[model samples]
Target: MTDMPDNIVMPFEIKPLGVRGRIVRLGAVVDDILHKHDYPAPVSALLAEAVALTAMLGASLKFDGKFILQTNSDGPVDLLVADFSSPSGIRGYARFDADMVAALKEPTPQALLGKGHLAMTIDQGQGMERYQGIVALGGVSLTEAALGYFQQSEQIPTRLRLAAGALAQRGLRPEAWRAGAIMVQHLPRDGGISPQPFDSGDAPEGSKEEVTEDDHWVKARLLLDTVEDHELLDPMLTPEELLYRLYHEDGVTVYPAVTLERHCTCSRDKVGDLLKSFSDDDRAHMNSNGVIDVTCEFCSTHYQFAPEEVEPAPEARAQAQ
Candidate 1:
C-alpha cells in the first residue's frame, strides 16, 4: 500500500569504504505478527528483532528460496522462529515460558535467551540443497552472534545493529510493535577480506597472532556503532535519510528497495496433510469431541476438520465399516 511504505529492505553500498549493506524497517507488518500472539513485551521485542534480521538476510538470496532464523536456548524465552520467503513474505513467532519470564530479575537479551545456539538456514525449495550455519549464544547479543556466524561460517567481516519497540502517538493511536536492522559486510576490491581469528585459550603459547582490520572497515564500523536504537526504529526517518546520515561522507549509493508484507504459508489443506501424517494414536489423541482443531502458530488461524477429512482413505473406510 502506498500509505504504508515503511516495510521495505533497501540495499546499499559505500564504494569508497568497500562495504555493502542492507537496511530493513518493518512497521505494520511486524505489528501484525506480534499481535497475533499475546506474547509478553520482552518476547515480542525479541521476536521483532529476529524478524527484522531475517528480512535483511533473506533479501540477499539470489534465488527463490526461504531464509529461516531460529534460536534454541535454556532461558525463559527458549525458542524463536522467523522465516522469510522469497519475493517478500515474512512471518515469525516466539515461544516462551511466561512464568519464567516474569520471574527474571532483568529481562536482558542474555537472560531471555540464556546459553543456546542461533541457527540460520537457507532452503532453496524442494530438490535443492539447504544450507545452515549455527553460532553459539554464550555471553553475546543477537547482533554479535550473527556477526560471529558470518565471521566463522562465511569468513566475512560484518557489523549489524537491531532494534525493536512499541511506538505510539501520545493521543492519536495505541502502541504498535516496530523493528529495524542494518547490516554491513566488508567487500574490498581485493576479493574478500578474512576476519580475524578468535583467540582459543587452549592454543599452545605463542600460537596467537594479532590481525589488524583494514582502515576503511574500521571507519565504516565506527560509523555503524554511532547509530542509536531510536534512529533505527523511527518511522519518520526514511531509509535514504538514515543512510545519508550514516554514510554521506563516503557517498552511499542505494538501489531500489524491495517491499515486504506479512504472509503466512499455513493453509487448511497443508494442516490437514500434516495431521494425516501423524500416527493413528497421535491423531486420536489430538481429536476433541467430533472434530480436530488446528491452530497455526504463525498467524493464529484456527481450522476444524472432521475425523474423516484428515484420515487416510483406507483408515476412514475401515472405521466406517
Candidate 2:
C-alpha cells in the first residue's frame, strides 16, 4: 500500500482561475469529527463526509464564522450533525437506533433519512445574517447530494472527498472505529466562465463561450471523478502529499497543514438544563422516583439529576443558568 502523511491543514490556494477563480484544500479532520460518535456504519460514514465537507467549505469562508451541517431524518439513523469553525475546529454527532443500526445496510440518503432536509448554517459570529441553506436529502450518498447543492445553491464547482471507514482503536479501545474525509471547492467567479479543468491549448476555445464552459466543466469533472476511495481514507497520504499527487500537474499551491481533533462539549449541568426545557408534567413523567437520567449520544456521557435538582431558572442556579 502507498504510505500516507500526518494530519495538517494540508495546502490550499485562493487565486484567480482563468480570469478570477478560487480554490480550496481540505484534509483528514473530517474523520476525526466522526470518531466522537458511535454511529452505525452507513450513518457514521455519511456524517463523516458531512463533517469534512463543512470544514472544507468553512475554510473558504471570507469572514470569521462557523459552518454547521445538520440533518433530521426518520430512518434507523435519526440525526447527524457536524460543526466547523473558521480556524477549523471540528465536532460532530450521529443518533440512531441501537438494535436497528447494527443490522443496517442502507446507503442512500433517502433510505437512510426517510424524509428530511439537509441544512447548512453559517454563523458569521458578528451578528451577521448567519447564512443558512436547507435542501431535500435527495438521492444516493451525501457526497453526491452535497456536490449538487454546491453547484445549484452555492454556485461553486466543489468536490467533497470523504473516507469514513473503520479505524483500529488505540490503547484499550480495541473495537472502536474512526473516520476521515477531505473537501475541495472551486469558488464562484465574476464571469460566468471558469478555467477549463484540462485543456492543452492556448486561448482556450470552443464552439462558443458556453461551449468552452461546458468543456471546462467536463474536464474538471473527469479529474474529480477519478479520485479513488483509497486516496481519501489512507492515513499515510497526509494532506500535502495527496494534493501534490492529484493536482500537481494542474499547478496547485498548498497553504499549510491544519491541526484537528475530536471534541465533546456535553456537561452534567448542561444535561440538567435540557431536562428543564420540558414542562413540569413532562419532567415528572420521565422521572423514576427522583433521578432523571440524561445521556449525551455523541460521547455517551451520562448525567443523572434528582428531581430536587430541577429548580426555577435563576442565573444563580448552576443548572438553570
Candidate 3:
C-alpha cells in the first residue's frame, strides 16, 4: 500500500478478467459534513456510508454533472440523501425520529429504513434529461443494497464493501469520522474472451469451488467478504495497500487517483431565487420577525432574506408596476 496524501478515489482493474474496481477513502471531508449535525452514531455512520458509496459509484460517470443517492422510508429514519457533483464534490444529510433512533441498540440500514426504496439519480446539468433508477432496500447493509441495485437495475454484476466510524486521536476536540468503500464490477465482455480463470487455492478454507463465470463472480465476492471494518476505516491504509492486501495474488493494477472534497452548492442567491417563486402571501407566511430564514438541508447553512431582497417574478413585478 502506498501512502496517499488525503481524500482520494482510486480506480483499479484486474487484468484479463474485465473486472474493474474503485477504492475511496474519505477523511476530513466526511468529518466536515458529519460534524455540522449532532447526529446519533448510527445515523452519522450510515450517512457516511452513503457519502463513500456516492464517491465510488459517481467515479464511473463520463458526464459533467451530479449523482445523487437517496432513500425514503416509513421507519424511524425517513429520509437520507447524499450528492456527488462532477469532479469530486460531495455532501450528505439524514432526517430521522430522534426518540426512535436513540432507542435502537444496533441500527442496521434495514432497521433505520424499514420498507424503504433506494434511488439513484443522475443529472447531466441543464437541458439534459435526468436519469433515475429505484430498487427496494432489502439487504443487510447499504453496500448489499447498492450491489442489488446494479444487478437488478443495470444488469451488472457488482460487489461492494463499505465502512464508517470515528477514530480517536489524542488532541482532537471530537473524534474524527472516517469512511471507505471498495467496489468491483465485471463489465460485459465482447467476442467471448473467457474470464481469466482464478485458482481458489489462495481462498480461505470452506470457500466454494470455482469453474465458470458465475463461479468467478462468487470467488470475487468471497474475496471482498474478507475485508474488515477496521481495514476500511483505517486512515493510514492507502488504496494500493488495501487492494494488494486483498487481491495481490490476482495482480492488481491501479489507475490515477481523483481527489474528493466536501462541497455544498447551496448559496444565498439560490435560496432567494427559490423564495421568489412563492406568492407574496406565501412568502409573508414564511417570514419570522419580519425576515425569512432558510437553512440548507445539505450543509445547514443559514440564509436570511428580507422581503425586498428577494426579487419578485416578472409577472409580479409587472403587476406591481
Question: Which candidate number has the best TM-score?
Answer: 1
**Per-residue alpha-carbon lDDT of candidate 1 for residues 101-144, written as tens digits (9 for 90 to 100):** 99988888888999999999999999999999999987677888
- Model 3 CA lDDT for position 50: 93
Listed per model in order, the count of residue pairs whose N, CA or C atoms clash below 3 Å is: 0, 17, 1
Give per-residue lDDT, candidate 1, residue 29.
95
RMSD in Å for model 3? 6.2
Q: Report lDDT (Cα) of residue 283, candidate 3.
A: 88
- For candidate 3, write residues 180-273 as lDDT tens digits: 9988877635523234344447877867465465555666667888999898888777777888888877788899988999999998888988
TM-score of each: 0.93, 0.75, 0.88
Q: How accurate is candidate 1 locally (lDDT)?
A: 0.90
Candidate 1 all-Cα RMSD: 2.9
Between candidates 1 and 3, the one scoring higher on lDDT is 1
Poorest 10 consecutive residues by lDDT, candidate 2: 16-25
Ranking of candidates on TM-score, top first: 1, 3, 2
lDDT of each: 0.90, 0.60, 0.83
Better of 2 and 3 by TM-score: 3
Which 10 consecutive positions of candidate 3 have the poorest summed lDDT? 191-200
